[model samples]
Target: MKKYLPLIIAILLLALAYLTGYSKYIGLAWYGKATLIGGAGGIILTLGAYWFDKNRLNITLIALFAITTAVTYYYARIFIDSADFEPTAGFVWYIGYHIGVALFIPTVAYILQKILPQSASIE
Candidate 1:
């Protein structure tokens, strides 16, 4: 389960992200701040799996989490003002956003750790 978890999460997030981004029907409805207990709540719950080995407080992960959270927060501040449907100012929502913009480097690192030959993994 641990080994396959990342891929599973990636798939699920990819799906939600697709629905939320591409579909015309869904968009922000309510206005509020969502606090995740830890690690962007690790949107990668759905996303942060790649960074799981590191403690949630690790500076790198923390920075990534902050970036994702801030991004979503601002997306709301700048784009979403009311309860009605409005065309998105951007192509996608940056928070919890399918592995996240801030997390891309980590995800790639995680993938490399898994896919590249074992010899290459030697530190």
Candidate 2:
């Protein structure tokens, strides 16, 4: 149990931060929701990669995350443009959301690697 304590904690924190609504306070309430949804979709792709022994497919899926993020930004732009609120404010909010998503992903991956160094399965 001691051996996996850190991994467990990290996963718990990830779930709480991403799955729960706590992240809304970070000025990204929508992103918190998007993260939960996007993470779910990512899980499906990742699990498929594992189940089929598809390394290339797994890497491709990871790359697709970045693409999805870019698309998210464009969607945000459209959403903001359509909103009646101050256009600048909406644009800034949308940009911030995408940036948060972009930053959180690599940071989470790095944290996971450090916490589970012996888990070669991450590769």
TM for every model, in the order presented, reads: 0.33, 0.42
What lDDT tens digits, residue by residue, belong to model 1 across residues 1-66? 454444445445534644465312332212123211222333344245334543232455567668
**RMSD after CA superposition, every candidate:** 11.3, 6.2
Error of 1 at 90 (Å): 4.6
> For model 1, what is the alpha-carbon lDDT of residue 54?
33
Cα displacement (Å) at residue 73, model 1 = 0.4
The local distance difference test score of model 1 is 0.43
| Top candidate when judged by lDDT against the true structure | 2
Candidate 1 accuracy as TM-score: 0.33
lDDT of 2 by residue, 24-118 (tens): 66543585565655445444543454445523343644666677677677766666676555765666566556555544534344345455654
Clashes of 1: 3
